[model samples]
Target: MTLSAPPVPDNDLMRYLRERGSTRNFKTDPIPDAWLEALLAAGQRAPTSSNMQVYSIVVVKDAQTKQKLAEFAGNQKHIIDSPVFLALCADLNGPALACEMHGTSFHGQTFEKGLVAAIDASLVGMTISLAAGTMGLSTVMIGAMRNKPLEVAELLGLPPRVFVVFGLCVGWPKTSPIPKPRLPMPAVVHQERYDASRLPELVEQYNRELAQYYRDQNRETPDDAWTQVISDKYSKPARQHLRQHLNTLGFGLE
Candidate 1:
């Protein structure tokens, strides 16, 4: 039997999803407390692995703290300029506490547990971003939060087994940025099986598209913009000390 494709709904949510872009230039307008609470509530509604909810979100509004975080994140001024900075953290501390309450020693130092917590934090962070967008707020995910994980933990007063996986800068947009182009769908989405025969072609196509996008925005970029950027980023050993740092943060990753 041939199954028909489901009808696509053209709605506000769909428009929001399509139009959402990283907001680096933000207005200094404060996010209302009610909206902040709502955003947190939205994050809590995200699905968790085994309902463990092994994640925490540290909200930073203080200018001084945001400045420090900005420095830690390679001096990204958005963290300081945005009204709110959120450190989305992977937290094994709560699970450990639960084990202690049962008079059992926690043996979740394995790589799988570490992965679970990271995934939990990532899911919640994305949810919060989406929710914020719906409320006329824009956000940018700061992966550089991992650049100084130990420092971030100390600054946030995170207990052992807790580390910032990433951060989010949220506020009103000073100006909307053009949504960056993405790789062709087939390049990423595999059908019934994993196919990579078209990867090189797809990458070249994406490179041209991204280069044109940059040109449209009057931004200087290499001809093979996406490919060149990726090459430069990964050519060197990036985040070589992350494993050791995570270990120090109590994620054994064994």
Candidate 2:
């Protein structure tokens, strides 16, 4: 049997996605409460594993709290600048409560359970980003929320089995930046199998493209920009205590 492809027309959503860039600088104007609610509602519609919905979003608007969170996130000004900072968290607490209601114990200490929660959180976060884009709002995801996981959790008053996977800053853009170039399709897409033969070649090609992109933006970067940045970042152990911290936060990650 043969399958036919649906004829899809070009639309604003596709254009917005292709051209969207991480927004670091944001206007101080607050997002309307109605808009925020709509965005969160859209995010909840994201597909979840087994309808578990094992994720939660903590919305932070207090200046002092944002200030503390900014410090915890390596002094990211965007976290403090954006009118709203969203802590997208992977939560096992709700599932545990559900099990209790049923008079059964929830064994969510396994790595698979931890992974599923993270995936669920990530899906919702991406959906929120897309929804925000549609509303002419911009955003940046802060993975630095994990830089000091324990401190972050403490600041947010997270309970056991609930930890922030990342953060999202949402607001109007203060300055519009062009989207960074991504790896070519040949580098990322494989034809029904894993491919590594062209990795080196692809890396070399992407380095040139990325370096030129930086140059055009008047940013100084090495010729081997991508390779050097990644190597320097990974040369030493990164977040060496992350596993212990996660365990302390009650994510078994076994």
Candidate 3:
């Protein structure tokens, strides 16, 4: 049976969240400039560290540019199909400049500063996804933009102290996929003090749940255990060169 899309909630944020899923298939329909601007405004409202919004959003609408971006992101068709693609960047130039103007020491090149900026940028991207969903739009986040960070920076004409964190595709969805099941609350959430005794059991139960979820969708289930899936993915050091890339962008990972 084809998994049906969850029903839209009646003014319920939680329900909407429960129904939310990453949309890979996007229609070619154009999003109105007003709607796009509104969505961006909503993303801008996300909380920032120390009120220092250390993030930049590069909105891409040009077809050839989108195609090149798609190629850079492992040839994801969604990047090209979506009417809009927003490249979210962890930026330190603004902070550095601000500090310079105030005759203070700039710390934007530090590893810790880069981490914080990345967090801020990720938060804004998530906010944009949620905002777009609420407005009957669909979105998919692409972290593969980091596959060639330097090339991406060059394509976007980013100066030193700025790095692309991720890309977000936005537009009307061609089809709605069911939300993938997440680990049970007990497995992820903890009471005041951390508890780990039941972790093994909890993980096993969720593994079964996810396996059944995949079976229900008639998708080929390769790995049944969630732990196994994660282990296999992280077994090798992926993106190990990112440290050097960040260094080249003026971030001191020291």
Candidate 4:
């Protein structure tokens, strides 16, 4: 089957997005306060769940703290090398306090609300990364912070009802990796209803594309395809104990 021509980006913002890719190698150059503030402002403008804004960012600039976080995050050297490390958290403490002042009950203790906070934090994190990219900065989100959630919370001095969803390493890029290919448009985007009739074929094509990407980067190719990567990461439990940890942290999973 012939694929249609890819649409050209209509503007600089769209073009930037198309060119966006994660950068692991970072320069030690410090991002200016003004640029940081602007990037944050851009994140603040991101949509949230009913404007509840159930997220917070803890900026870690202390060398010792980054070192500790590097250890916590599976010894990813980039965590320590980046100029700024941000612990993006799902925060309900502020809303709970607000409810207290109003003599009202805060209703975000349920498991669904926990999910909401996670979603909110993730949305803001993406927004911040995009804003950073717009300013020629690079970012890599660290998912390994969940490896030791209780310790990370203790290290960051988070209050009850707040948990780090992930950490983000942001700085000037030493180099940019090629943008990874995604599943074909049809494989992901369905028109009016759900459809997967062509999924297998589309995914097979994607596997070839990704294999080529790996070969170009001189990286070891995983067997099978993206499905194998997904299965390998998720076959067993990646972080099976997080539910209990979240409960201990006051999320309660009610």
Q: For this target, which candidate reaches the highest TM-score against the unseen true structure?
A: 1
Where does model 3 exceed 4 Å of error? 1-10, 223-225
Question: For each predicted model, how many residue pairs clash, with residues at least 3 apart or on different chains?
Answer: 0, 0, 0, 0
* Candidate 3 local Cα displacement, residue 113, angstroms: 0.7
Candidate 2 has its poorest 10 consecutive residues by lDDT at 3-12
TM-score of 2: 0.96
Could you tell which candidate, 1 or 4, scores higher by TM-score? 1
TM-score of each: 0.96, 0.96, 0.92, 0.93
lDDT (tens digit, per residue) of candidate 4 on 37-64:
8888888888999888999999998889
- Taking all chains together, the TM-score of candidate 1 against the true structure is 0.96
Off by over 4 Å in 4: 1-9
Backbone clashes, candidate 2: 0
Off by over 4 Å in 2: 1-8
Worst 10 residues of 4 by lDDT: 222-231
| Tens digits of per-residue lDDT for model 2, 1-254 | 88888877768789888889999999999999999999999999999999999999999999999999999888999999999999999999889999999999889988999999999999999999999998899999999999999999988899999989999999999887599999878898999998989999999999999999999999999999899999999898988888899999999986
True lDDT of residue 177, candidate 2: 57
